[model samples]
Target: MTLRVRDLDPENPADLDGITAVLRAAVPPMLVTPELLWWQSARAPAAQCHRLLLAEDEEGRVIGRGSTGLAHESPEPGLAFCNVYVHPEHEGRGAGTALVSAAEEYLASIGARTAFSWVLDGERNLGFARRSGWSPSRSARFQRLDLTAPLRPLAPPPPGVELRPATAFADDPRPLFLLDAEATADEPSDVGTELDDYEEWLATSWGHPLLDRDLTTVALVDGVPAAFSIAHTDGADRYSSGMTGTARAHRGRGLAKLAKHDSLSRARAAGLTEAYTSNDTENAPMLAINEWFGYVPAVTEVRHAKPLG
Candidate 1:
């Protein structure tokens, strides 16, 4: 069966549905939707040069999809990423390879010197990356919690600390952005990211379609945003923690836990039944917090990288 690769058309409903279906089948813990896919491809910063690639068989069915882009926010330049996902039933049909090749060519064309990808931790997936000349770097685990289960009672916020919905800062989100920037800089990862562009963050994060401000919880200390747990919902039963972080000064104060617990409770109250989150294997603090929240390990994916000419 001959296959062809092409850029995704966000305006095309069929394209949106096809890619979303493939992603959902390939990675069940992930929360994706047609609207989220559209927003990612359309609102990405220009410097990132983001492209959503689709692999179609001769029958015109989208069997695989790839998200490729530059690590524009990294302090280091010439870094690019391409994460490809193929429907389980279609995995051995060369769709994943075709999508990756097409993605690399595009990244190289845009001045990228190295490409990175996340491969599910399985012999088949790892073998594919190895054959493609990529080497393992680090791994992260996806976890899930049954929000319908009984949650441990949250303790009262320490004196001078308050738990509030992120919506409270709707009038001005710059404070949240600042805290996010600080916390994200400390996240353990192979590719370091610097969230310095406030405007870009506003466009890609603050204005994102899935950001549920009402469900997101923030910990405030003396009226200052100290830590936060950002929430993303599919407008259905699925909920994901986009990010949870605490400011440097707030470290060891349990603010991150406070924020995430409140956020998860709010999500459950809002009718979200499943909650999902991911943390790098080296991030013991966040992992411990999630475990305390009753999140169990779901799957792990290893980050792999290859240099390009």
Candidate 2:
């Protein structure tokens, strides 16, 4: 009946599979392939100092997992995050608390002055966060669309605009990066981020394992990327909208919607049966866009923050 939390060795296949199993059991909709896990927890740049931890019982079976890392892209310093998840069958154990404690200690040791975590919107999860001295800050909604159903046809782009797959920019993704950076700065979030380092963005985001370039759609205004819909696929039937945004200059042109529509159509054609995306509760425009695309509310999670001296 004993339980212990330990840092997961990224080089160990057993640990990777164990975490993957935990994720599958807890969050079935979000796909977590080995490649995606490695890209996130292992290949993260040294600046982020990402750490993945697992909680195991006396039998050495993984029943919970935690992820901790700095918000490296935030222009504001001293911000970090730690999210903990336990198997439903093992919720009453101390694994979640131990993992969160370890995460806060590690972050504090690394110079973090404030830590953030996402707790599923529920009485138990909220109660746990409250007991740990964390307060809810912002909430986000996860939405999913049945890609197997017929999607409304996308309207044609303006005469000067053309819709293209993100793969078209493979030889040079910097343009898309610029668009992403601009759009990201405008997106609603408690933890604001700016993509200032091109190399870092290239290493972490552009090179992410789940990113599906061929299915990602972009709107080109006279051959310049004006809006884009970044897609992440699990190599199966699941697809996620990593981001769907338009540059400020192109906001009123419906370029963002065009990009997302095209991306969703391509994803369905690619045999992806499910589409998932998350939006800050206050992001009304994005929320309306998702609703138009037939995405239904799946779950909500509140961002909890705790200040650490």
Candidate 3:
């Protein structure tokens, strides 16, 4: 039976559910759902130019999924990404290869000169990526913490520091945005991103459907947002940290830890059962913070890259 690859029709309910199932099958811990997929592919900032693709077998069952797009926020030219995930039950059917090919074609059509993707840290996935001309790069560790466990109480903030919910700045999140941009610039990554567009940041990050401003914690210095722990909820019991960082000037003050601790405590109080976060293995500071919070490593993913001709 022949396998075919095509763009996912988000408008079609079956296609949406099929792709969501494929994602869940590939990574059971992922918080992906049809609603989240739609939010990403259809409502994300226009600069992202996101595309979703699906691979179907002769019987029209979706066995693989691919997400592709240009990294619009990056100052570099011709930079793109394509993440492919195939159901474990259908691995030998060439669905992954087909999906990658289609994704690359789409990226090239949009003038992308390079592509990046994440492959699970395993021999099979690594071999497949190497076979596709992708070379290994920096890796990231995903961690999870059980909210049901006894959490360490958050220590009081320093005399001049204040910890509060991000929602307090709903009328003006510019201070938080500035802190995020500064922290993001210093984060360890193969692809350096510059968040120069505040409007774009507002639309994509601030207005995101999953963003839980009420649960997100922020540490302020003299009323200026200096550190934050952004939160995203699955509308269930699962919560994920979108980004946690402290401004350069506030790095040694333990503000990031304070914000994260406050956020996690609030999350547990709000009945959130699970919390997840990921960090570059090279980021010693953040890793140490996660360790202090009792977050255990769940999965490791290796970043891979290939040049486009």
- The worst-scoring run of ten residues by lDDT in candidate 3 lies at 39-48
**Candidate 1 ranges beyond 4 A from true positions:** none
Which candidate should be chosen as best, given lDDT against the real structure?
1
| Residue pairs in candidate 2 whose N, alpha carbon or C atoms collide under 3 angstroms | none
RMSD of each: 0.7, 1.1, 1.2
Q: In lDDT terms, how accurate is model 3?
A: 0.90
lDDT of each: 0.93, 0.89, 0.90
Task: Highest TM-score: give the candidate number.
Answer: 1
lDDT of 3 by residue, 110-154 (tens): 899999998988999999999989999999998999999979877
* lDDT (10s digit) by residue, model 2, range 1-309: 798899887777888888888887777666688777766777888988999889999999899999998998898999999999888888988989989999999999999999889888899999999999999988998899999999987778879999999788889999988999999999988889999888888888889889999989989999899999999998889999999999998897788899999999988988889999999999998999999999999888899999987
Give the TM-score (vs. native) of candidate 3.
Answer: 0.97
lDDT of 2 at 261: 93
Candidate number that wins on lDDT, 1 or 2: 1
State the displacement of the C-alpha of residue 24, model 2, in Å, after optimal TM-score superposition.
Answer: 2.5
